[model samples]
Target: MSDVLVAVETVSRAKQLKAATGALHEALDARMMGADLFSSRDRYALFLAMQRRLHAGIAPLYGEPALAALVPDLPGRAKLVEIDRDFADIGATPPADEPVFVDPKDVPAALGWLYVAEGSSLGAAFLLKAAEALGLSVEHGARHLAAHPEGRGLHWRRFTQALDAVELTEAEEARAEAAAVVAFRRVSRIAEETLAGA
Candidate 1:
């Protein structure tokens, strides 16, 4: 079990989409920040690829129970709900269908919410992993999305912590590294190949 996927195994395969997507996003954001500060596009692109790979990888989970829970069964409501919330929280609205990074100027703002969403997913997966490690399970019932609190709070907390660690001092930021980045890439690749083989 590759670490990337392993981190999310406690989550139902259906919910894996959310976890994977979130992990990939965090990896990307971390990479970007790392690159921006270190002046290393190599590092930036590495994380960027991770983010893209994760997005591509999680495409299958659109109908997974966990994801579906957040989205309404009605057409066009599920994905849009998050987008709406993001806009509402940020007090800025981009077109519903605008590309996420088409305009480089919006990168910072886009990344803010992207990181939050992704961080939440990462946190939830971390919680799920911890529970499983302790021999527990999350029974996400039908309508779980309704019951599942938004992960934004948890994600933002982690996000701010990361930012603080990095911004405070070089030594402090080193402590905040994503120990899981390399592991995630390895696992994600294996999972991709396995899925392709299947």
Candidate 2:
């Protein structure tokens, strides 16, 4: 591990993940933006499709038995159903291509992927507003961006608590950080591909 990763491991896992992945998160967010994403229904649908693709990639992680033991609410957090509602509202269908996949081999890697997925909910407030600017809403569209049923802050707090409770060795921590970076990169790639073709 690098000095930065070593330093991050001293903090709570959630904080370590946020610090370690901040640059990639910002880079991917920048790359994911385009006028069409918030301007037109067609483009917005493409954006939602990209989101679905990214979620699908990590869906399997939520089902891992070891991870389930750590975070029992994991399986219920998938955004696919909500994304489907958004797609329906926009009258768009998912692309025909096979979905991208991100396989995390162990508990540490799974936690890394879950860190990205769960952390995303914290930013959904802004996305909900953006979707509203496109005339989408929690009831009619943009369900995926709707505030979590438990409230975003509370939901995130619970998830982070679970994350911090897990014990990992130095090498495992490094693997977790790498998994998070990979997750962000995969989402960025999906966004780039979707937007380029849009």
Candidate 3:
């Protein structure tokens, strides 16, 4: 709905989403960077806390009938269990919360939030490397950040192909963009609150 949204029909839905949320993503990334997320285990725990919340929040999206119809392999991508293992590996009690988008009435908007969740995987390669610096590994405290067995590039390609194939109305497109901004802002808020203590 804002000036950043372009002709949605002219570009892939994935790009439309990226363009719509570019500013928000930059801000979120900057905020996370300043949080010193991997300087030590204590700080990294904060990162995992937020990751736990996020993964739990979006885990159901992978199974939602409408979304699954769009992304067939969606159900296999959940990482909540991996996050829990990371907590156990470090002997930390994992935090708990309901899904961020609880049975969202707006499927289009739900897709936007789901986009943020799946899109995070695309950046996990870097995050996983940072975790390794903290003496974490895929089998240890960084399982959630590990690339998909199919690999991040191929996995993301399958996801985007599914997303870009959708035909949505102008209003639906706007809603999707707005929902993505909201999702990113939520992550920023969660990170800020959690890292404040770290």
Candidate 4:
């Protein structure tokens, strides 16, 4: 158990979740090579390829009963199609390599993965603007970074509400936190690979 997790034990599950995953998030961001991504079209395409890989890795979890029951919108949230649209708009094809698989063996772990995915939509507001600066838009490209149809804030609140509503043993909670860190690391690696390829 991490000291951060231990310290957040008394907080709401959502807060605990955020606190536990904070370090992993920061580390992943540091490795994402954001400045380089926005510097060129090829770099931006590589970033989208990385997004495709990460989203594909977790796409299977949306169908799990435990996850689907809580997040009904899960099925529609797969970003691969939107990513493909963005690729077409940019005159690029998706990379041929297989995605890094991120399998969560149980419900709690799936929740952890979903937390990262759903939370990403909240951050996409900034990314969307950055994409626009590259001449991409929700209608033409960057659909994956577009604001949710239901609105970002409402969508995230619903997700966190369902997340907190789930009951878990301490062990399960730890597993969830661990899974979140794993998700971050996997995406970070993909980002690094994308930048290298760019």
Q: What is the TM-score of each candidate against the true structure?
A: 0.25, 0.88, 0.90, 0.87
List lDDT for all candidates, in order.
0.34, 0.81, 0.85, 0.79
Model 1 clashing-pair count: 1
In model 1, the runs with Cα more than 4 Å from the true position are 1-38, 63-67, 70-151, 154-198
Steric collisions counted per model:
1, 0, 0, 0
Q: Is candidate 2 or candidate 4 better by lDDT?
A: 2
Residue 168 deviation, candidate 3, in Å? Answer: 1.5
User: Best-fitting candidate, measured by TM-score?
Assistant: 3
- Candidate 4's C-alpha runs over 4 A off are 1-10, 97-100
Per-residue lDDT of 1-198 in model 1, one digit per residue for the tens?
A: 666644543332213223545567566446434443113323222322333333333333343443333333312212334433433433333232323321222222222233333443444444344333433334321111121344546434544444332222333222223322333554355334433422
Candidate 1 global CA lDDT score: 0.34
Can you list the residue pairs that collide in candidate 3? none
Please give, for residues 37-150, the per-residue lDDT of candidate 3 as tens digits.
898888888889999888788777777888888888878888889899999998887877745664654678878987898888999998989999989999999998999888
* Candidate 1 positional error at 8, Å: 26
| Superposed Cα deviation of residue 114, candidate 3 (Å) | 1.3
* True-vs-predicted CA distance for residue 84, candidate 3, Å: 0.9
